[model samples]
Target: MKDVLMNERHMLSRRKMLGGAGAISAAVAAASVSKVAMAALPEPVIQTKPDTMPPLVPNTGRPYNPVVTLNGWTLPWRMNNGVKEFHLVAEPVVREMSPGFKAHLWGYNGQSPGPTIEVVEGDRVRLFVTNKLGELTSIHWHGQRLPNGMDGVTGLNQPGIPPGKTYVYEFVARRPGTFMYHPHADEMVQMAMGMMGFWITHPKGKHPLIDEVDRDFCFLLNAYDIDPGAATPKIMTMLDFNLWSWNSRIFPGIDPLVVRHMDKVRIRVGNLTMTNHPIHLHGHEFLITGTDGGPTPKSTRQYEVTADIAVGQMRQMDFLADEEGDWAFHCHKSHHTMNAMGHDVPTMIGVDHRGVAKQITKLIPDYMVMGERGMKDMTEMEMPLPDNTAAMMAGTGPFGAVGMGGMFSVVKVRKDQKRGDYSDPGWYQHPPGTVAYEFTGALPDPARFKADVSPGPGSMPSMAKPAQDVEVKVRKPAGGHSGH
Candidate 1:
């Protein structure tokens, strides 16, 4: 029976090759691939680097512009006769979140936040999902309009793909937009282990809604709750994920969005974590062009400096890279930019622990007093870290320490950057008198303004006048109870 299915698919594919696809029904490609020798699954392509790979231009399918996945790579698919086929293997892998830190996670292909899958609109897509893990898992095509049975819900739509078994998903790329893929089975543990990836369906032609840009980039927002010196995340952690990441990578690990000067750039960002993120870009303003549902209407578009991405939402922004300098791009949430933070540590601002440190050091020599001034000093000071742990803040800029960690990256818009080139152009070299300089002259007292008072009837004279220093003397009580 399975051999018959394989032979039928082979014949249908041959028909598709001979331009007989018009008569083929969707049900013909709905069945799982056969175990026959001719129905072998396409070999899965794996990427080992945690860097932004070049855009993967489709060579076998309909032509369309590709997107660069920051700190990730696109999954290469093989065209079987005519249908684009992709194979995804769910298994345990090690992902280096930053230079000095690596986490044990379960993901597709080879790394956490698995390689992105790009397809063209209106193309027939077939995915061979082979589960190599020790448990059941399924891939939910987030925000894709497909047959209800192919929705990938473990119980509602279909049963879970058991361990070491292969399940097939067949769908047509009906729309052109960005989406996410992750396990619907054991979501809390599997997703927390970083089992997720991005999917992009590009428009086949010059669609009216989609714009042409020089640089198109995509990444997913995720987080991990791993302890110091640990390689696995605490799956039960709900609200307190210590290590926030972009594509399972932290600052210093995340690559910059290098763009040519004045080039129109598009950045697609999706949030799969448990919280919302206000993604902010410096030195430029952008319009919210696309979302997970679809492209925003032109009349409804507005310019914004920061796009707030809610949980399970995708926001693609388009901007002109007019500024010719390295600009900071990061999450507006302060804590999200920190890595492996000590949440229970008390803030030591304005506390003089010098004498106490001396006494404590006598008992424990390695006890270091930190946060006395601010945590920024840790970026500059040489401090010891736990095994396989990244610092709270890392990275060095041209001048000094960048003092940033997770969910932080730079946008380097250089005048010398070339088209189709995503290489780092190094730090921007400012022209004469363009860079900010320190004042060596005498410093003057900062100017101050008095609080404004609104005009109202029957208001006191003191309220209307400028604020002046007032002195009041309090009489001591006759009993003199010593302020008890």
Candidate 2:
């Protein structure tokens, strides 16, 4: 029923690429299919790259706008006798948090946070999950209303899928909204190992609340507790995660959101971490149009520049990209923008470490002093880092190195960008008279006063002002009242 007039050619191209997909009936899924019997199960397509795949346009069902996953991809489904079927394989994966840095984690297919699963509101959908992990696992579809048996909770709704077994889930997407899926059994270690995914249920036909947008983007907020130079996450750490990432990727690795000038854009964000994130966008204000509950009432919507998303929550924001520039879009938390090595470093501001460096270098030849002024020097200095560790900050712009990392990216709004073209259109060129320039005039230095009080030799100078000595003078009252 996807009768969208536009993108017919692209949809044809997409359908031809994946239209060969077909899976066995529900009864066949009751028995676990071995490697030799792969022909009886749906083909498990795996993606290892951290780049975003092309949006999957619906080729066989109700038409709707497809969401572009940042550093992720949507899972492809096969239309089988009016029921949409998808195959998910749970296994170990090596995810690249940044260039040349990888994390040993467990995920679906070949990436952490898994591939997104998109479906229409009224379509009958079927999911085939194959567990290749060491222990039992099951998936709970968050914010979804389905049959109790199909709810996917271990021991509550059904038994957990054992290792080397496959399970089938069939249901109709009763409501339309943004949702998520993760394991309910051993979720603490599994989610810490990065097992999660995004879900979207598009409303059928023209709904009264939803509107058309030029670009729709989606991603998840997740964190990790991997130590420096390590390749695996510490699954027991709850409050002190070292890496804050979007879709299991740090900034300079996450792709930018590019849109045409004046185009309407909708961004959906899901937080899976333990802490809250205040997502702030520069140079534009937006309205939160939707959440996990569904589309918000028009009367309650308000324009805001930052929306704080709590744990296990989703926030959808809509705005018009009228300004043409490369604007910042990131979390407002300062520490969340740093890499693994950025945290736990002691502050040495205003304390000259030169004296300490000379004393330490006598005993150890390789002792180096740092942070005497601030951490900005770390972005410039070529310090020796350990193996398999990400830089504290990376990414070079037209001016110089962009001193940022983790959960940071630019929203590049341009005028010449072609429709449906998602390639990164380089840096923005600012117009003259619009940018701030350094003044060429003269300036005065600050003044400081010398204290009158002085301590003994070899003592530091006191910064406090000296108190003035004054004489107390009293006058006799005209009328005496003390004796009376």
Candidate 3:
């Protein structure tokens, strides 16, 4: 199998080169034969803007859309005849995980997790990938069923898209499903550096169940192990990853999923991390309707409050936005929902370090004991961190500073939200009588009873009761009792 694939790749590369040469030869012959005609030919039209239209829901004409990613957008494609043409430039990018934090990562078209690629099922797509990095790279269309030659596997389906060179992949989008794209060459390092994107193919025509949805969203799950003060990810560290994100963004910095009340919504989540994520939706239940393979059969769809997206897998969740409020939608793994954490800290819950800290402060004036009681105070302490350190575990909520960070975000559904508006509607307001309060004017009394009283050595006498108490009788045993 390996030998066969290699031969095919070499043959394809030769064909591509010969095809280019043949086109040039033909153009030269034409120009030589008719110089005047060549001069009179009109200039080719150049498009400065993309002709991409808003994506549609699966079976319905209703537009289910995602809010703009905090620092990302959908890739724009141009229509050439009936084919869609997209250009991707793979290079290094400086992405801000949130305010005060940034990382040096590699991505396509200027953003990590790249841009969402949306197309109708059965459309012919011509994707041109230009590699600007110093090393060779290849983009594998994850979960897309296409010709083997266009599979984008380096040295397997085709040659590596060499640095400073552009490679073209043409394919007919076969199935309507959630998919992803990333480098298959040096996959571990490239993926760890944030080279990935979402690929979404809408179903052709209308399907009874998937056609119409009120809101649609797509995000890629990724993890990193960049230290708090590091600007670049430590690609070698896989198990000890500290930065968890959805589309390279942590919560509070990530845009909330906004929808109108009662709107049918679909959120497409793709996991590129090594670990599985049990994504839980607070205040609502969703059905797993589709996978990367294709749409799930109606009979097989199962409703769930949390859906597990495994490594290199994708899931499409559908739900009705019947509830109104800012509901949390996040990974259920406790630590997965938090930003950078110190994994080597010891238990300090009951350790009293005041005396030790006092002595150390005399030698080092700025020194302070940390984690002695708990870590909640660390959120407020502006300790000296290394240069380029990102405040990994930090966020501010309405009530106060939020200590939790990372793969967490809210899904906001508002009843009075304006149509086509994706803005947040603030926090939820309770009805006049729904809020909890302290009960002050309440009284209860226990039943009173009388019993014989006996005291042992070293025992104290029973305390006197109020006027409503029953009388007690004292008793002495026939033989003197010794108390030990």
**Candidate achieving the largest lDDT:** 1
Which has the greatest TM-score? 1
lDDT of each: 0.84, 0.83, 0.72
* Clashes per model (N, Cα, C within 3 A): 0, 0, 8
Across residues 74-154, which tens digit of lDDT does each residue of candidate 1 receive? 877777767788878788989999997899998987788888889988988888887778988999999999999889999
Q: For candidate 2, lDDT tens digit of each residue in 65-154?
A: 999999888877777677777877788889999988899999988889898999989988878887879999998889998999878889
- The order by descending lDDT is 1, 2, 3
Native-structure RMSD, model 2: 12.0
Model 2, residue 299: C-alpha shift (Å) = 0.7
Better of 2 and 3 by lDDT: 2
Query: What is the number of residue pairs that collide in model 2?
Result: 0
